[model samples]
Target: MEMLSGAEMVVRALQDEGVEYIFGYPGGAVLHIYDALFQQDTVNHILVRHEQAATHAADGYARSTGKPGVVLVTSGPGATNAITGIATAFMDSIPMVVLSGQVRSDWIGDDAFQETDMVGLSRPIVKHSFMVRDPRQIPEMIKKAFYIANTGRPGPVLVDIPKDHTAPHNTFPYEYPKKVKMRSYAPVTRGHSGQIRKAVDELLKAKRPVLYAGGGVVQGEASQALTALARKLNFPVTNTLMGLGAYPGSDEQFLGMLGMHGTYEANMAMHNADVILVAGARLDDRVTNDARKFCPGAKIIHIDIDPASISKNVAAHIPIVGPVKQVLEEMLTMLDEQGEVGTDTKSLERWWQEIAGWRKVHGLRYETNEQGPMKPQQVVQALYKATKGEAYVTSDVGQHQMFAAQHYLYDRPRQWINSGGLGTMGFGLPAAMGVQFAHPDAVVACVTGEGSIQMNIQELSTCLQYGLPIKIININNQALGMVRQWQDMQYGGRHSQSYMESLPDFVKLAESYGHVGMLVEKLEDLDGAMEEAFALKDRLVFMDIYVDPTEHVYPMHIADGSMRDMWLSKTERT
Candidate 1:
């Protein structure tokens, strides 16, 4: 039997990895990979309008399915186009494999046609990157890429293949690489018993303690373990945005999301805690607000899969490098052995009462006139009510994204998909399409601002063509919401053309794509509109919501401010 080329070997390896779908756009340098796709029958390809959209879609697919998202694009512009998506996935810690074709090996570094050093370009954004100089190495590179992407802390990986390597008549047979060869890639398991003992000792000693959960909890699927740990220790668990669904929102110990836009109580808990058990999350700039002042009295113990993340942003007194799930499980076992795993129902009851008091004082809710334009919060909350909080939600960048983050009770971790790292505009629509495609049984919603919607409104056709049922709720404020808000607050309220004069009627736009379009004016109609959208089968529905321009996401941690420095209301004293 004849051996396949490098390009063919990649496709075969991806098939073996159980990749059923791919997102990409073809170009000259990557034509060989596309050609190989034609000869294969396992993986289906989705040709997006742009390479950026392709990578975002792949990200959505991976987030929804918990599988490696595969994307293929040509070299040069194609590779560059994927930068934003890669960065978005990187920040959010998503598993994705991006494949780009390169110039022939002979034409290296001579300003070859449509050639760029993709491996170098993608280094900062990907977990690992590989450039295949030999055809025989293609399989091994792909295997390694997938392994790196899905294991421990998930992230995007890039594989660049030279054009010459894809041609037949190469000496090597098609055998995929079995394992990655990185000495530093080994993830720490649940073996740090001394650290666990120290964490437990500190937990018992501290009067005010909190469990600071981050995205790592979700990535490690350690929700159960985290819940057990918190329950046994009688500590409230406050999550960062990436760790939203670490524990059920209904749980007594689950404090709402913490960060710049996190709940007031969550931030307050962080500030007041005497000890913090940091698990599976990177305490980014937003979360720390003021790192020096953050948890001023708290002794912090950090547990993460990646060692660099331990001391990169926030200082940790006790750093436990291990898979989050493994670490939590080991801690739970040790607690059980020490006869300290049983919950104190009375103490937990008191903790719940305290949390309830905070909720009464700070939980998100609002009142708006039913006769006028809708409030963004009202629209989002109504969607939450209409869907019974079961639908997967994606958001474009801006005030609308913040609104969703504040109001929506995301039941699952990956269910809340947004461009957090990149804050990329026009991410919701395409990402929602990808999410719905991957999970056809679940209804998906894209909450986007008017300006952000127009960034990729072209994808409406993609939604229609694929018969994807996506509810696109456009919070049409007729301005770049974030910039306009900044102008109103920081700049002299001059507006400075931040607001657009003419905006297209999104209902008509949806109709042009052979889809249903609904106009929402009054708050009373919001629930009805969502119900109608949910009832539709294989149809794209655009809900044009006229939201108030003055409505800003409250408790906002202004840019570069500490999470504690949040404004509770327009008139509240910061």
Candidate 2:
């Protein structure tokens, strides 16, 4: 082994893990590591404007590529700024390794400069966290961080390295381990045969069944298996917000997204189902508004890698704790072997007819005018048509996000990436940057609202500097559209701080960053603007599409309300 500095060891460890890119913002504390990074040519470092954006970029990189995203940041405020991103990744189970530089070891607990309890601050959000007390432990810590972040239920992992540890003279020879085996960290990969049998038995006996899939299926790489199971049993599948692309949105068996702002057919299916096969999805409050009333008549079969997630919100009659892909494969194999289970074909057809009726009556309807003030749904639909549903789509949290989810049909996994769990407003721009970085040749787009776009709008410079051809679609409504919708519905339209009195001309802002910018105010201009944006292959394009200010997401279910209690629009009740 060659003698190395802690900073050098850090770089070496990253190289050993085949890390090609690192998103980070440097500071005084991480100067040595930055110097080491500067000397290295194998790993490319992306300098983000803020620490939070760095983590978000990494998260996007991970989610799109199915590889663990790496992030580097300084201590104190740097680490604190990364908390929202860390929590965002954690809540969605995205694999990320966050390396943070801490204050010197000798000054521990002395209230040193640029110091914070990184471990304590991050413990709750991170899958695992470590404070590197010794420089020799750097290799092991880095390995553990990556392993924990990517294995089992993928999530963010933080490793805080003290300033003294990175000093040139304080490190020992680096020895990277070939493998890591933690006795207590084993994750179940296969479901029990007996449990699988029971789940199949339930599916065969039910008259009306629904398949609820989530991000876990995407993360577990079980989308094909999920599709096969849904098709073989002739089940209508509904994806959670995080599971948007887990099943083909265009499939006839697909019932669109479920829960608040979910499809009328999907929500109705859940409300009226007799058997619910939930795979890789946690019944979060957003999906099950009132846990007690969620699928009241359904015998839920929950399958997940994390055992604690089962029955945490909605009760599960059969719970299978295992990896989604493996469990689904076994279930499919068992079904083929068992042959027909005497399922009622006529009853299933009748259930589909009822679902079809709901779809026909209340399916994703929106109003638009060709003259002026284009609807957000129209813009999204135009973008989808322009790209032919081939681009990677990321969305900032708001009505625009819901509209994108509703309008754009994603046929493949990893094609639709967004901040679903944490609902971070500033997630889109930075995340699009990451997605573009990961797939430089692929078309990448970010759908953002007026308010959410401003949160990480500075990243446009990052895009221009890196020459990332990310299409930024700003759905300009001049208000916090989702909050305004809530206020309009719940608070008698008081409109507290939801309206933006003065908003920047996004086109001029894009031009200021030396990028192409286009504005679309009329519905007729949307397709042309989207086509121009999609045709660009060299420069980043910012398209500010002005939408109707009063537009709101529909089929909205109130807090603790039943799935059937959906409001079709502001003035229409379903």
The candidate that wins on lDDT is 2
Q: Write the per-residue lDDT of candidate 1 for residues 1-574, one digit (tens) a residue.
A: 4478777787788898889889888988877778888987889888788888888888888877788888999889999988888998998898999999898999979989989999999998898999887787788888888988999789999999888888654535766555577787775556477987787777666666779887788778888899888877878888877677677665667778888777877877777676889998888887888676677888988999888888787789988888888888988887788784544456555655666666676735555765666789988888898888878999999989888877888767777888776688978887887797799878899999889888888888878777888989899888888888778777877788789778998899899989899998877777888888878857888999988887766676656555567777765724
Q: Which portions of model 2 show Cα errors greater than 4 Å?
A: 340-342, 370-372
What pairs collide in candidate 1? 139-177, 140-177, 216-280, 289-562, 289-563
Q: What lDDT does candidate 2 reach at residue 134?
A: 89
lDDT by residue (tens digit), candidate 2, 1-574: 6999999999999999999899999997798899999997999999999999999999999999999999999988999999999999999999999999999998879998889999999999999998998899999999998998998899999999999899977668889998999987987868888999899888888899999999999999999999998888888999999998899999999999999989999999999999999999999999998888887888999999999899999888999999999989988898888787466788899999999999997658977665657788888899899989988999999999999999999999999999999999999999998999999999999999889989999898898889999998899999999999989888998999999988998899999999998988887677887888888889899998888999889888977778887888766776
Number of backbone collisions per candidate: 5, 0
TM-score of each: 0.94, 0.98
Model 1 global lDDT (CA atoms, 0 to 1): 0.81
